[model samples]
Target chain A: MPVSNSLRSLLPVLILLVLFALVPLLSPSNRFLSLAISAGINVIALYGLSVLFGQTGILSMGHAALVGIGAYTAAIVARDFNVGFWLSIPLAGIMAAIVAALIGVPSLRVSGHHFVIMTFAFGQLLSIILTNGGDYTGAASGLDVQQPVALFGLSMDVLTHYYLMVVSFVALSAIASWAIINSRYGRTLRAIRENEKLAASLGINVGRHKIGAFVVSGIFAGVSGVLLAYFLRHISPSQFASFPSIYLALMVMIGGARLLLGPLAGGILVAFLPELLNLDPVQSRILYGVCLIAVILLLPNGLIAGIVAGWYRFFDRRPVQPNEPAVEREGK
Target chain B: MDVLLQQILNGLSIASVITLIAVGVTLIFGLTGIINFAHGEFLMVGSIVTWLAVSNGVSFWLAIILAMIVVAVMGFALERGLFRFTLERPTNGFIVSLGLIIVLQHIVILFWNANQKSIPRPLNTVWEIGGVRIASVRVMVIFITAAVVAMTFVAITRSRYGRALRASVEDRDTAALMGIPVRRYITGVFVLGSALAGLGGGLLIALFPITPFTGGTMVMKGFAVALIGGLGNLTGAVVAGLILGIVEGLSAGYGFSGWTDAYSFGLMILVLLFRPNGLFGGTSGPKMA
Candidate 1:
């Protein structure tokens, strides 16, 4: 890469990395660390979702199931078989990815409301299975997990785990998002989203692309789930319910799904919005519902897209070429 | 055999309540091309209103009718105020309806204090035939629900209003070109659907307690049944409703009592996987159009 191109490419991520490294050192409080950890987890999960939602244009209402799969897989493996945390975490993501692929075969056939309902039921079924599997799965109370594995000779502690989570959070989101958005696969997925029939006519395998998106989404959700389980030390069916999935989708929408900064903004908002408002549990939900409405009405293309469009119009100092009228350019 | 009969009766009672909700959902989808996520909230409003009215010295029958009328008015107001402007954007209407669900839910909580309220059943009569005992309230619900279903079926199929509704569903622009009052028909359908939902809610009050959050599960069931029997197919919705009711009843009966609640949702997922168009959903081509 050219020197200027490399610097331009690395600048934003370097800034983000510096910010992540400084967060814990500046705050150092347990509560802040906890909140930061939770937000990190959400960012990771939302990363996978942005790929499927922003790239493939598939709206899944049951993504928490994939997260649950990751959490439970990690929990069960680490607890029952006493596997290392590193080994168990990846296993959780793989398990979720496999299940997502299986479901995607049929789900990719349906679109719009049909796909939404399909994913919704899939999430419900995952919860039911966890709740019904009495002794082995611990039924409704959810299973518990063991502590983190030491990295070689180094002992793992909570603060260390928190930083590790932050690193993974930044790395997974930035790398995965950059890779997908720039790849040929991502282009094909975008084509499918724009117009599936047209994409098929152009020799794109729409179904395979959709399944790949679902699997990739599930993989991210799973890894996030494992991190969540490790951070909390417990996993419950309630944690993976439909409400969280809806909240995740809303977060992506509010932050701007197609933008890298969108999930980060959303994760922060979803985490702190309730606390900032000091809302009671039920009232918090009402506020969330209202927020969803406000976002949809005001930000049709999402907050990031809105801001970008506004920024480009204001600061970009290109002369108004009469032949290249703004309206005609925008029409494309 | 008696246990089976009792279970069947129980299933029928459940189906009676679900049929009302499902049919309303189907009607709204058919006529307006809008999915009212808040349809369950209307049921919630119906039940809460009936409970409040009856507790405040109104006759049960009067309270039930009053609830239906009130919900119908709310439906009309909704169409006139919000839905009419959103006809060009169905997706906007859907998301807005979800917002309405939260707003309505909070309003209920604010008024009713989040407590579960039970309506008193006036009927103490019971029938024991061939060693099977049937609660009079269940029998009453079944008869009333059956009558409503029959009347609704006839009204939609034979009446001039029904023909207009059918015309609107077939092609909204063509119906307008044919000089049919499309807006009036849409509003009427919304009102009628809400009335049925309210009526169902009132009847359901005899069997179960009502809470502010009760409509969420019921709405999921309505969606499931509507999908299974096929959207825009009234007869299919009715059959699907009964099938769902029976599935839940059997799940509750066969020692997996808690699993009963998950049965419909599970069935919905399974059906979507195998038959995305639903069991009787005809013509996959026009699903979106």
Candidate 2:
């Protein structure tokens, strides 16, 4: 407990400083830069889902809808109005957050399997609307986003996008992970996850907390989507299909849903595994299924959780000192 | 009047297929609380197997029987290899099933290609009555579905195996305490459920082209039907399937063919919002146990 307390006390500041120093140097090559960029986007998106799933215990099969909303918002603003990238990015994220809140209103009424169905339906409906929205959404052909413009005299390029994504992903994941574990709000959310009625009896407004988490999750997903749109310079309904939501869920599970960096670890593993294998789309999906099953069966606590716990045990081998009450309390 | 009769007949044929699929899904979910998304892939496999068997000169009925047996084996293997491992963690079980769906669909694509494949029509007659036109094949489908449903009803309500399965559904631990072999019953349900799915696939081949991607639509519709009737409710699945078939038929007839897919999902969302327990399925309340 004392060892863990000391590590926890220093982790945040260490992580932030390390990330800030390492991000700019991450562009080893164009391919590496792109993978890093995409991984960052995935981390941002899964951050939202993790809060809902890990914290609030609501499984949303439609988190991609928020991503799609953000992507489309950026696409529409950039392509249609020829707006600046800086202006459109925030606008898109804002629009996605708002849409997520609206859908969350109805979704907050249900939880567990019922919530899963609602989110799945919402995602499907969004896809249908986007596909059939005709001229506005470019119909089934999808929308084409222009390359982002120069900001602060720095040209928009692969390296720039990669660094930007890394900054956003690390910044958001850190805040969200810290906020959930350290804040009273996080305590209430976790309590609701453990037992809704019990949490309610403890004077927590379960419904409001659920909606709040949903909204916050949506904001993270929106930011991810906006970055993704810029990275690809094109957005399509097909890219944000139901399957992506499933993949996100798989990533969360594989990374160990209970941990903050779980999504990042899971996302990178899943995303890179397929590319590394040079698998076709169908084969990739099949591998994902197989991988998911293996992970669930062998490592239910997820890859990161198992590793982190193992690392903690291996390093902190010393027995507790009797005079370490303050350290013990912090650890607990 | 003629159009109405034809539409009604069409509705019945579709409803029968849905009943086969939904009841299978409902039975498994009812007994085990495992939402097997891969259930539709069983149907897909069965159809392709029957197609292969029939093309090789096997009799239609014989091909169907063999396909059902094969799917039953696959179901058993899946249960032992995957589902059994995740019984204590149902959410993980769901993800596992979903993964299976992807794997199975890809396997289909590998063998059958992505193009649509059609089974040779074994029955080519059209039967007309009361100004209604029904394909002889479709009538056969309706008859087969009715017979299966009737047989299942008797088995569930009257047979010893049915009693044990029901007891297991009510309470697995208590059923075990009461001398029921819960594992055996679950294995039996998985086999039976897979067979029902195989039968549905065989029947569906007569009405629609089989494509590698066909399982997703069927799975979604089946889930919607199960949700509509309430989770694990057999009779609820029947009524709900029929209602869904009719709604789909009418939607397609009224020139909203594109929205036909949306209709079931829309209905499911409404149900989740208004009656999470389902219409006749009776209290699908989350099992905290």
Candidate 3:
């Protein structure tokens, strides 16, 4: 695809992101900011998920474990040593990546349902360890992350944290994801997703690329988890369990994992729906599940594509150029 | 000797419940190829319905029967509304089932509060032999689950519907081409599976305390058992469920209670890694998306 066409393709996403960036300033309320920050963290987290499910074609019901690992790393370090947020946060991502690599290497060999189960078992075991690790993980009830990160000698406040989450977490992820997807690495993952045997036959290091995608995803989850710990200021086993992975899956699907800005849309909806509707946990979870099923049935391609497909149908119009593929950029 | 006997008995009772759930899950997988995570929700609701019916002055046995009918109907509706479209895609079916799980748990919670509820055993007696004491309810659970499994075996081996279902599982398209009403048979498999889940739930209310959240663990163990036994392998599921029950029983009994959950998951992952084809000889068939 041409550069102008690719930029045109990303126009809608850019517009949506510009609107999201202005939300904190426009709303100016702690409650709203909290939701935005939570969504922002999830958006970052689900980027890894998109890479896994959408790009690498692996379903990890254990992605939450990576997040937990990251959060635990940050919380344990900060609580014990009173380390600053910057170092702790990056360390969280690095630790999560390390753990992801460890778990992913062996498990990634198994594809489809078996692979999903492997990750799920891994996630469940990690949760058990965190809950039963006693003083180390603050046990099941959770640990208090009392210290906030300092940026330019500014102790963290809600607004500042929100901005930090957006800039450091979301922007950094988007840039990294953009860079990777644009690089040969991204094309290789998409190739693997489309057909592993064919890609391998074409001289791809299939296993390495798969592990690399997972590690990159783990990094995203770790940073998001670190942000979640700081944002919530309290972390618990319940916060990072199997359900969170499903919840992340819901967001990715709802926003359209195939689209660059899909997680952003998904993140905002999932993070705020409970608070916005004042729904109890049960009701909210039910809603999420219903939403997930609805998405899978009606929007298999994802929310953006589904909506676009519906729009095109309503208009009964094919693309203006029959010879050109609409928005086809070879995984970039 | 008494302790060993006790643990063995304990393991048998738990394995019976697991077999009921696992067989149901594997049955659906065999016929329809959906790993209905909401299958455990049937078990949860079955118990809850039995509790509600029994508390409302119905006879315990009658309530159990009613629960089975109700859940079977619910299973039918879910099959028609949701699972039908997902038959071709196992992954989509999984996501749909996850959705159903969320939906079913919340629906139950909406009607019955999330508080854990325990039902009094219908038999309310203990049988003691050789210094090993056993609750009559436990005996009933084991016996009833055995009867159900035996009946299922007979149905599969002897009955026309069972033959058709088996054929469908063997090769869905061929079964259809050979004039088997494949979709209807698949639906029957789901209803029968759900009924088994209901029966397990009914038995469960007599022996174990339950809440809506209990379905999560039930599904995990059921799915694990189904995998270990091999998907669609009846005998394999039973053996796997028994092994899992014994392992869990011993772990809980021997004071490694905190690690028991981890222990079960470890078993599942190990099976997944070492025996992806399954212990009893069913091949892996989940399609890659």
* Top-lDDT structure, candidate number: 3
Which candidate number would show the highest TM-score if scored against the true structure?
3
Q: Which lDDT tens digits does candidate 3 get at residues A198-236?
A: 999999989998888889999999988888787778999
- Which residue segments of model 3 deviate by more than 4 Å? A8-15, A106-108, A274-278, A316-332, B286-289
Question: Comparing to the true complex, what docking class would candidate 1 get?
Answer: acceptable
Pick the winner on TM-score between candidates 2 and 3. Answer: 3
Clashing pairs in 1: none
Candidate 1: tens digits of C-alpha lDDT, residues A121-146:
77877888888878777889998876
Report RMSD (Å) for each prediction in the order shown. 4.1, 4.8, 3.4
In order, the Cα lDDT scores of the candidates are 0.77, 0.77, 0.80
Ranking by lDDT: 3, 1, 2
Model 2, B186-269: lDDT tens digits are 878888999999988888887878887777678778878888898777789899999988888876776766677677778888
TM-score, A chain, model 2: 0.84
What 10-residue stretch in candidate 3 chain B is worst by lDDT? B280-289
What is the Cα-based lDDT of residue B54 in candidate 1? Answer: 91
Model 3 / residue B241 / CA error / Å: 1.2
Which ranking of candidates, highest DockQ first?
3, 2, 1
Name every residue pair that clashes in candidate 3: none
